[model samples]
Target: MILKTYRWSFVVTALGLVLAAWYGLSAHLGIGQAIALVLILSILEISLSFDNAVVNATILERMSDFWRKIFLSVGIIIAVFGMRLVFPIVLVSVTAGLGPIEVIRLALEGGDPETPGTYGYELHEAHPTIASFGGMFLLMLFLNFIFGEKEHHWLGPIERALEKVGKLDYVQVIVAGAVLLVVAETFATEHGRTVLASGLAGIVTYLLVNGLGELFNVEDHVEHEDPATTSAGTTASGVNGPSGAARATGKAAFFLFLYLEVLDASFSFDGVIGAFAITSDPVIIAIGLGVGAMYIRSMTVHLVEEGTLAQYPYLENGALWAIGALAVILLLSIEVEIPEVVTGLIGLAFIVASLISSIRYNRAHPEEAHVEQHHAAQPG
Candidate 1:
C-alpha cells in the first residue's frame, strides 16, 4: 500500500513533462529544452534531497494521518514557493532593487540579451557578496550540525532558573526572538545583508509555519492509531498494549523530518543561485525543481512506511551529518566559490552511502520490520 502511494509521485512527474511539452509546442518555447530542463532539475533536486527523505521519514513517521497529508500538501507549497520562488527574489529585491515579478520575468526569459552588466535578472555586475554570504551561511550550518547541541529536555540548572521566571515555552520564545533580532540586525550591513537575511528568513519562516501547525493542531496522530496492515493487539510481556518506547521513537522521527526541511533550504541556497547560471525562467526552474521536489516528498513517505530508519540506525546518523555539512556549505556559498554541482554530489554521496548501508543492515537485521509491525499494531 505504501509503495503504491509513492509511485504516484513518479507518475506525476511524467505527466507534468507531457503537459509542459504540449504547452511549449503550442508556443515559441522549445519543447525539447523545457523537457530536458525539467528532467535534469527534477533529478538534481531529488539527489540533493536524499538527506531530506531520510530526515522527513523520521518526522512523518510520528505524525497522525491527517497531519501527514498536510505535510505532503502544505509542506510542498512551502518548499516550492518559499524556497525556490520567494527566497531568491527576496535576495534580488533587497540587494538590487529589482521588482519581484520583474526579476522572475528575467529568470523566465533567461536574462536580458541586451543588458550590460546583468545576466537575465541575475546581476553579473554586482560584487560577489551573494556567494560570500552563501559560503558563510553554509559554514555556520556545518558547524551547528557538527558541534551544536542535539535535542535536550532537562537543561538541569538552567531549566530550573528559567522555570522560576516563566514556563519553558516563554524561555524558548525569548531565546528564539533574540536570535531573530540579532540576525535581522546583522543584515543591516551592506555587504552581507542578503546572506544574513536568508538565514533570518529561514528561521522566521520555520517559526511561523511551525507555530501555525502547532497552534492549529496540525500534527500527525500516529500516536493514536496504527496503519491497517499492522495488528493492534497483544504485547511481548502480555501487557495488552504497544510499547511506549516505539511510539516515542516514531514521534522523534517526525520532528526529525521537520528539521530536515529546514536543513534542505540551507543546502538549496547554492543550487538556486547556481541555477541562474543555467537559465532564469521561473517556469522552467519551477518545472524542473518542482518535479524533483515531488519525488523527494514521495521518497520521504516510503522511507517511513518501509521502516528503513529503524532498520538502519546509521542512516539517521548519516543524514544528520549530511544536513549539518550542507548547512555549512550553504553558509560558505554566500561568500565562497564552491560549485553547486559539487554541493549536490557531496550530499548525494552521503545519502547514498547511508542508503547502501541501510540496505545491507536490513539484510542482516531482518527482524527490524517485525519490531516496526509490533509497534504499529500497538497504535501510534
Candidate 2:
C-alpha cells in the first residue's frame, strides 16, 4: 500500500526529468549536466526536508482521508508553485515595485547569477526581511516542539527538563519574543526596523495560525462528542470508519488545513531561497523542488502506513532540534551568509544521530516500543 501511494512521486520525478532535458536544451547545457544538476537538486531537497517529511507524517496521520488527499495534491501545488514560483515573484514585486511580467523576466532571463539585475540576485537584498519572518516562525515551531511534553525522548534528562519548563504560562510566546528581539537587534541599522517588523509579523502569523487550529479543534471535539474505540479500547476519532479515518469536515478541519499550509510554507522558505545558489532559473528550481516535495509527501504517507513515528520516537525529537538549528542559522544569516550545504548537513547529522539513538532505544526498551505500536493502531 505504501509503495502504491508513491506512484505520484514516480510520475512527478519522471516529469522533472523531462523538464530538466528541456531546460538543458534551452540553456545549451550538456544533457549530462542538466540531469546531474536536477539529480543534485532533488537530493539536496530530500536531505534538507527529510525531517520535514517526518514532521508532516505526524500531523497528516491525525487528519481525515479527505484532508490527507488535499495535503498530497493541493498541498503539493502550493509547495511547488506557491512557494517556489509565485512567492519569489511576490517578494521581488514587493521589494522592487516591479510588474508581474518584469518580475518573471527578471527571474528567468535577467542579470547573471554573479551580478545584480536578476530576481535571484535581488532576492538576497531582501534577505533580512525574509529571514526575519521565516526565522521567527521556524523558531516558534522549534520552541513549541522541544518545549512540549513528548511521550518519548532520545535525550531523556534534557527533554524531560524542557517538558517541565513547557508548563510555564505563555512560555513559548515569551521566549520566542525575547529571541526575536535579540536577533533583530543584531541586524544593521539600515534594516533593523524592517527586520523587527518582519520578525514580529512572523511571530503573529504563528500565533494566529496555531490559535485558530486549536480553536477549530475544540469545535471538532464538541461536534464529535462520542469518540470511537479500537478493539483494545484505545480512543479514536469518531468520524473515521473501518476503511479509513472519518471524513473530517467542518471549521476545525478547515483551520487545521490552513495551519498546516502555513507551517509547510515556513519549512519551505529556506529551501526556496537556498535553491538560488544551485540554479538561478526559477523554472528548474520549481521542477526540482516540486519533484522533491512530492516524494516528501509520499514518504510521509509511507511513514504513516508503516507506523515509523510510533516505532521511532526520537526521530521527531531530532527533527525538532534540526528545526531549532535552522532557525538559529536563519537568524544569524541576517548578518552573515551561511552555506546551504551546511544547513542541510546539520539537519542530516541530527537525523542520523536520532536514527542510531532510536535503534538503541528500540533494543533497550522493546516492550515500550510494542506499547507505542499498540496505541498507534488506534485511529486519531
Candidate 3:
C-alpha cells in the first residue's frame, strides 16, 4: 500500500539521488565531499521541513487523487526552482541592483575573498525582509488553525480556549498586525520599514491566496450534496466527486494547491538563506535541498496514505504549533543570528513531543474511532 500510494515519490527520490551525485561531481568537491554535503543538506531540508510535511498531509488528504498527483508533480518543481534557485537570485537582484546572471555567478563562485562581498552576504543581509514576510505569513497560518474549531485537540485547554475566543474572528488578524509592527520596530532604523512592509506583504499575501481558495471551494459553497454521494461527499463507488460526476472540477482543490505552493515558498525563504551557511555552492544547495524536497513530498504522501494525522490528532496541532514557534524564531533572528541547527532542533523537539503525546493519547483512547462513529450516527 505504501509503495503504490507513494510510487511517484519514490521515483522523485531516486532522481534526486542521481542528480545530487552528478551535481556534486561537477562541482569538483571530490565525490566524497560532494556526496557528504548533499546528504547533509538533504538532511537539513528534511529536518527543517517535517512540520511542513505534516501540514501538507493534512491539506492533501482532503483533496482528490488527481489534485494529489498535481501536487506531487508541479508542486515539487515550484519548490525546487522557485524556492531554491530563482527566489534567492531575484531577491539579490532586487536588493543589490545586480543582474540575474551576475547574481547567479556570484552565488556559484561564492564570496570575493578580498572585497568581503558575496552572494551569501547579500542574501544574508536581506534576511530581515525574508524573515519578515515568511514569518508573518506563517504566523497567520498557525494562528488561524489554532483559532478555528476542529475535531481533534492535542492541547485541549489552550486550543479550546483559543477557539472560544476565536468568536471574534478578527482577533488573530489584529494580533498578527500588532506583532508584525513590534517585530519591525525591533529592527534598526534602516531595516525597520522594510521589515514592516515585508511582514505586511506576508500577511496580505496569505489573506489574498487563502481567500481565493475559499472563494472557489465547491464543498465550502455547496448548498446541498447530491444524494448519489450519500452525505460523505463521495460517490457510490467511493471516489470524492461531489455531484456524482466522473471528475470534480476541483477548483477549490486547485486554488488550495496554489496556496500550498506559496506556503512552500514561504518556508523555503529561510532555508535558502540558511543554506549559504552550509555551503555557498548554488549547485550543492539546489541539489541537496532538492533531494530533501523530494523526500518531503514523499513523506507528505506517506502520512496521508497511512492516515497518520487521523491516527494521532495531536500531530497536526504540534506541527502548527511548531510553525508558530518557527515564525517567532524567524522574526527574532532578524535582530540576532540564530544558527540553522537551532531552528531545526526546535522544530524536531516539537515534533517528538507531539509524537509522544499522541502515543499516550492513543493508548488512553483506543476507542477514539468508536467515539467518532457515535457522533456520526447522530443526526444534525
What tens-digit string does per-residue lDDT give for candidate 1 at 1-380?
65586676767688769866975676467899778877777777776767767766755665556556666777777777787777766666656777877766655556552364343345432323444333333333333233322221122354345435543334434543454344335633444455455555554545554443334332242253334434332111111222233232243334434554565565555556666556656666666776777778888777766656655545665675576567556444434567767777887777677667767665776786566545444423
Q: Which candidate gets the maximum TM-score versus the true structure?
A: 2
Q: Distance (Å) between predicted and true CA of 289, model 3?
A: 0.4
Clashes of 3: 0
- The TM-score obtained by model 1 is 0.67
Candidate 1, position 238, lDDT: 10
Per residue, candidate 3 scores C-alpha lDDT tens digits across 131-209 of 9999999999988887776666768889899988878958879989999877767554568899999999999998888
Tell me each candidate's TM-score.
0.67, 0.89, 0.87
Error in Å for residue 85 of model 1: 3.2
Cα RMSD of predicted structure 2:
4.0
Off by more than 4 A, model 1: 1-3, 112-222, 225-264, 355-380
Give the clashing residue pairs of candidate 3, or none: none
Model 3 residue runs over 4 Å out of place are: 5-10, 112-115, 187-190, 219-249, 369-380
Number of clashing residue pairs in every model? 42, 3, 0
Worst 10 residues of 1 by lDDT: 234-243
